[model samples]
Target: MTESPLTIPIYDGSLVSVRSTGSSMTKAQLTTGLARRKAEPEPKWKSGELPSKYQCPSCSNYLRFPVQFEDCGHYVCSSCLPDIMRVASRCPTCQVPISKDKLVNDKTLQKDIQSLEVYCTNKDKGCDWDGTLRDFPVHFETCGFISVDCLNGCGAKFEKRFMNKHQKDDCPKRTVSCEFCKTSIIFEDEIPHLNVCTEFKIPCPNQCSTEEYPRGKMQDHLENDCTKQESPCPFNECGCEYRGHRPDIEKHMKEAPGIHLNMAGKTIALQKKLLQLYEERSNEQKNWIEILARKVNGLEKNYGAQYIWKIDHYSERLQEARSNKKTTLFSPPFSTSRHGYRLALSICLCGDGKAKGKNVSLFICICRGDYDSLLTWPFSHRVTFTLLDQCEDPDNRRHITYAVKPNVCKENRPFLGRPITDRNASFGAQKFTDLDAMSTLEYIKDDTIYIKVEIDNEEMVPI
Candidate 1:
């Protein structure tokens, strides 16, 4: 009903017979020239020339076949389809969405499109991909600059060609953590994530269990909801086993003699024995001084007046030494009534950490039950201590910690060690912070209670 899109041939009378462009020409002319033919027939005036076989717009293959498109007369026949559409489903000639109906059954187009060189759509955007129109759309989507993952850090790949979306986000190569906490998160965060996943719990301080949970629920788990609870008894081997809540054993130990008596402040009688030992040591020192004076006097009388006068002459010096030498004794103001629940004990001792015998001052801080009365050396002698059968692995063993040093411990430089003890010992951070409950932890590996020692630097001293 309308004019043909192509201009009519202009001719002069003098022998001018011309062949028309038929509205389509050099593929380049498909660009600028198409504008001049503004009135070209809708059915494509003389049906533009078919795609060549070499360029094979039909099958996108060199082999000729009856594939073609009605819109643009470009497509692959059913037989040539799989090879031409390798990675793309768009038409080879028209560059439209591939569909079963778009396929043309004209071998002429298959052989004709071969002569045309199709530029990939991405070529305008810097992609230099070149292929027959059939593979051009596919090539454009998979261009190297299309932003692919570098895996380790750079690069691109044909992602849509594969069923799986991608190993990574950008180009399928970066490293990423699991969005589900427990699922395998290949390279990048997944599209969506579930925070409440129970399998992906966090690491807990107790080192017991890990599970994924909300931050609020995490707090509840750490405080009280933990599924597992464990507490070991301090007495490792003596079989004075006790575990569980503090209130339970605190009441039980009050009645159990073997466990309780060994613990301090429970018995009225044991307290009395400690006071007696203090007195006995005092008496021994006094007796030794009198015996020494008597022997010196006897020697003076028997040896002769010279020796006796010599002793007599040195009597002034002897008096001075006696006056200066202070005798050591155990002393505490006697209070018949025991201090209730106060397990604090203080003591002074001469420690021998070095051969020269460095005189060092240190005090032990512990609890009443840290030491056993049955031990006799310290608990009964000092004010208080923590008792145990073993130092390590307290659940199965017994160990002890003395809150105070005994007066009689001479040159005994005790240390805080892995085994028996280490002189220059340090408690674990937890033990260090808890000054009060450290003795109870000695029920595990507690700090050491240092005893003072006396040393002589005479060996290195300059006269």
Candidate 2:
């Protein structure tokens, strides 16, 4: 073959014969040929860079293998074909009228354009894929994007992508059970159906909830959250499950408690068999209270007088000793007295009748001074000071005071006066002068009272 195309020897592991032929060129020759082809001038095509990187304005997507109108410079991504055919059937850039079939399709160019597509902008939203311009719209509609579901108690999930906007508007998964009625509905429908459910459980009419509520706990269940519920009698604590209604509750009180009192109505009865039994108990309590009270006209006439007697028998003895003059230290014979301080006095009135008129006026005069009620008040004894009768005689002037003194002796902290001041004056200001009988009782006095304590010291303006 014409000198065998001038064979040359090459080393490719072993010696091999290489030849240059018109059909089979040498490596350098093939490379030189390619270079020459690249450097050669290519005839200018009618559309330079035709069907390249044009993007659709409507979709904001890269146009692969752009389709051009026959008469216009306007180009569009092939991916937006169906959309562009509808309203904008003309070339967008050149404003030329177009028919759907007039646009060109370049399959070879489209393949090249396809290689240029990239990952979707929404890839981070739980999508994991890439696509070409012509195929990306379909992929986006199906891509699973994780988003919060509108349903109550529904956990977060990757929902179907296409319905994102639609699910937000008409999603059935966004429903919740109502607290009042326990009915299921969309959260937005809650306000509408709040009063709709007929079988909804609500609080009972008579009482508060106790236990296993909305079943038996009614309005009479004692307005408390932690109240002991109406449970089976603890006669046997093995969870006696016999829960009873509130009205008949007393029948199930703990087996036996020594003291029993029943309130049938206005009368509180200390019930027992014998009238003497009632008398004995009341007398015992009466003795306990009289320990502090000045023995006066029929004091032991109220309830629980016997219980007080048992509490303060010794105090009663000391009081009786002082009264009988049997104790030598308590009352000194012919004791001489000298006043060391001045006593302050003032009068105020509080009346339920609210009358400033003397008829309904509550008259109060307090002998205020250095000597304490501890020493002076007991002289009146553990007693209540209350209005007994209004003095009608203008001459007597002093409001008539009567009281069932120490009437609340059963309660150690019984009220002793109306609006009692929680203060005691104990400063030693004035020095002693008199040592015997001529010493007058010195008292410091004030007459004004305040409606509220926060106001600055009030000036007593004369009327």
Cα lDDT tens digits, model 1, 1-463, are 1111232121121121112223422211111111223222111111233335343454233333344545564543333354344446666666776554344444344435443455543344465655554454356556553444434433444433332344434434445666445465434344433344544546665555555555446667754545443343444233556764344545555667576445544344565887799789879988998998889755433231110000122224223433544211122212111221112212212221231112212233223332223222222223322333334564665433333323434334232111132122211111211222323433322223322211111121111
Error of 2 at 194 (Å): 8.1
* C-alpha TM-score for every candidate: 0.20, 0.24
Model 2, position 167, has a per-residue lDDT of: 50
TM-score of 2: 0.24
Worst 10 residues of 1 by lDDT: 304-313
- Per-candidate Cα lDDT values, in order, are 0.36, 0.36
- Tell me the tens digit of each residue's lDDT in model 2 across 1-463: 1111333112122211222222432221111122232332222112333233444444443443345555664555544444445556666666678765355544444456555555654565545676555466466555566343444344444465644554565554566788866777886677667655554445544434432334334333443442444434433233233455433344655432222212222122323445668799899989878864744312322211111001123234334443543221111111001211112211112111222112212111222334333232311222222221123454553322222223324232223232145322211111111112111221101221111001011121111
Model 2 stretches astray by more than 4 angstroms: 1-52, 56-61, 69-74, 77-103, 124-127, 146-173, 177-463
RMSD to true structure for each model, in Å? 31.6, 29.8
